[model samples]
Target: MKVLHVITGLGVGGAEQQLRLLLRHLPARCEVVTLTHPGPVADGLRADGVPVVHLGMTGNRDLSALPRLTRLVRAGRYDLVHTHLYRACLYGRLAARLAGVRAVVATEHSLGETQTEGRPLTAGVRALYLAGERLGSTTVAVSPTVAARLRRWGVPASRIEVVPNGIDLARFRFDPVRRHRTRRRLGLPDDAFVVGGIGRLVPGKRFDVLVRALARLPGDCRLLLVGGGPDEHVLRREARRAGVADRVLLTGERPGLPDGSPGPDLPSLACAMDVLASPSPEEAFGLAAVEGLASGLPVLYAACPALEDLPPHTAPAARRVPCGDEEFGRALAEVRAAGPGPRTAPEAARHYCITRSAARLMDVYATALARQSLSPAPQGVSSA
Candidate 1:
């Protein structure tokens, strides 16, 4: 089936990373469409030979391209219009409906607590987003926690499906040779325990808290921060103020996408780490933590409801630090002293393999299409 995926932008984030893996590993039949102008992610997708259509969206709520989006969907004769993130979800579904696509589906990537850009006009945007989810043929949440959130917000339980985010185990699995090589290449001390964080340098990610936690840890420990954004300068100054400047190695922002590149050294870099920390208070689903586990390193994260689907072993490996730096520091020290335990590489792979997620999504697509075919069209709805 021809599936066109619409997302806000092709930047490095969990949703964008998931999109790349799905296109790379999904059956040859799937295709993609990104609403925002092509960015770094487009380079990765194009490298993998996936077609990405750029909508050239300049501002939020840019309905100017709605007609063009409709034309594109109609021209492609897409079987399904699947969207990720809020803006694309809204615009993708509306365009699909206008183009008479068979099914319009949207994946709720994040809880929508923080904003990268764009301002909502009023309370109506939230209402409209909820309404859009309801009107769409199916709504997919990355985890059961998100699905529950949708139901709590009044989306019919029948309409919401839980399809967890997945990672490419092959790309992220532990590689011993690469581990030593990556550690050496990055110039990290072999004796020092490294705590790595990969995320957009945003307030929600709480890099400042990580810096504070590092302040409390011994001088021997080091923090490696990857990715760059609005929070870079603030976080740099935070490290200086915390008096942990020497202990922190801020890469500012590395190339490729979140979870690092699909490079030879990426897996090693992950596996070489003693611990990977995610201090975000509101994680919908953790791709980095899973990748860390897959790489044979322990993970530490702030307690978040969406993490319920992660395997019990992951939680055991992960020290659930509180939202504050003091608590985080204490927890980090404990985990680092003990060191990462037996590698649960196989277990992690089983839980988050992209191939498994693709098969599951295919099932969702097939089930939704079968139901739509068997049932009569809505009062005003039409088929592809």
Candidate 2:
């Protein structure tokens, strides 16, 4: 089948990376469209031979791109249009309908109960989201937590499918050689007890909490905050205020691979660290935590919807702690004392491999296509 994937931006984030990985395993002929900034991921996708189109949408008010996007969809003659993130879902769904595409699907990568990407949910945003959601055949929720949130937001339960985010296991496998090499490259002391947190430096990620926890730990312990964002100054101030500025290491935003590519080398980074800490109070799937586990590092998280949903036997080496500095400090101490929990980290990762996730997604796509075939063509949009 021919499929077109649409996203708000082609940045090195979870959803964008997931799409890049999913296309590798999916049997369908796939292409991509970025409604805004076609960042590094766009280059990586092109390097992988996937055609990517940048719609050059200047801002949220740019409705002029709708006709252009609809034309592209019609010309591609795609069997399905799959949307990811917020802006793409909103516009892609409408464009697909305008192109007379019967099967349109979306993946919800970052939605939570209290806020979305650290912003409060306003009534205007809710109405806009629901309006766009109505144009799609189904929405793929990355975790049970996201699925529940969609339902609470008035999306019919039947239209929501829970497909956990996945990783490429081979790329994330633990390696002693890589560990030493990465640590050396980062200039980390060979004997230091490193605690790492990976994600955008957003308020909701709670990197401040991790900094606080680091201050409470011994001098031998250090914190590595990965990824880049506008909150860098704020977090730096946080580290200084906590009196652990020296112990806090901000790597800015490292490329996913050493080749200057987009994505995350979380596996290698995880190997360099003794433990991984995800103190984010809200997360859809906690991809970083899962990757840390896959890399054979014990993970301490404030919230992990994906890990919590996993069967006990298949769960990774993760411990959920209350969201606070003291609680996280204590949890870190406990984890350091116990050492890396069972060697089941890799085993847990296998259950959420990209290959398995792609297969499940194919099933969802097939079901949506079949349903669309049976129903009369949707009205209000003419075929191009």
Candidate 3:
């Protein structure tokens, strides 16, 4: 089937990266439309031979792009239009309906209990999101906790589908040789105790807490902050203020490989470290934590509903801790004292492979198509 994916932007965030990975495994004839900021991910998709159209949406209030998007949808003759992120969900649903496409689906990849994207969920935002949600056939939630949150926000339980975010396990598998190589490339000492955190440098991620925790640890410990965002300067200032700037290493956003590979060898970075820490209190799905587990490292996270929802056998190496510097430091000490524990990385990541996620998504697509076949199109509908 012909499918078109609509997203807010193609920046190097969780949702954007997940979409790039999903396209690698999906069988449908797929194309992409980015509303704005067609960044590195866009280049990677094009290198992989996927057509990407950039709609130069000046801002959120640029309604003129609606007709342009609708025209593109009609011209493409797509059987399905799937939307990701907030702005795309809002405009893509409307555009798909205008183009007379009946099979439209959206994925909610970044919603938490109290925040949408590091901001409080105001009433106006909820109303707008709910209005957009009504135009789609189904909404895919990335986790059970997010599904529950959608229901609480007034979305019908029947309309929500829980599909966990997946990782390419082969790319993240543990390799001692690669681990040593990565450590040397990053200029890290062989015997240093490294604690790594991966995510956009946003306020909600709480990287400052991690910096403070590093200060509270012993002299040989260090912090590695991966990914970049608006708060990079703020985090650097925080590290300096905490007197741990010397121990904190920040690698600003790394580009994907030029060959359009599925991953950036994140597992190599994870393997180079002794432990992984995720202190974000508003995670929809802890992708980094899962990758760390798959890399055979103990993970300490503050809030990961996805990990908690899974069976104990799935990720036995993940431990939950309170959200504070002292608690995080204490947990780190305990984990270091206990050593690496068991080698459950491969088993823990078995359930979250990208191939499995792609099959489940195809199932969702088939279900939507079947439901559409049973319903009659409304009369007097016109393409915009």
Top candidate when judged by lDDT against the true structure:
3
Give the 10-residue window scoring lowest on summed lDDT in candidate 2: 253-262
Candidate 1 lDDT = 0.75
Better of 2 and 3 by lDDT: 3
- Cα lDDT tens digits for candidate 2, 10-116: 87677888888888889999999999888878888888889999999998789998999999999999999999988889889999988989799999999988776
The full ranking of all candidates by TM-score, starting with the best, is: 3, 2, 1
- Global Cα lDDT for candidate 2: 0.85
Alpha carbon RMSD to native, model 1? 3.0
Q: Which regions of candidate 2 deviate over 4 angstroms?
A: 256-262, 340-346, 377-379
Global lDDT of each candidate:
0.75, 0.85, 0.86
What lDDT tens digits, residue by residue, belong to model 1 across residues 47-121? 777788888887776778888888898999888888888888888887887787758788887863433223432
What digit string (tens of lDDT, one per residue) describes model 3 on residues 270-330? 8788889999988898888888887878889988876888887777778888889999989
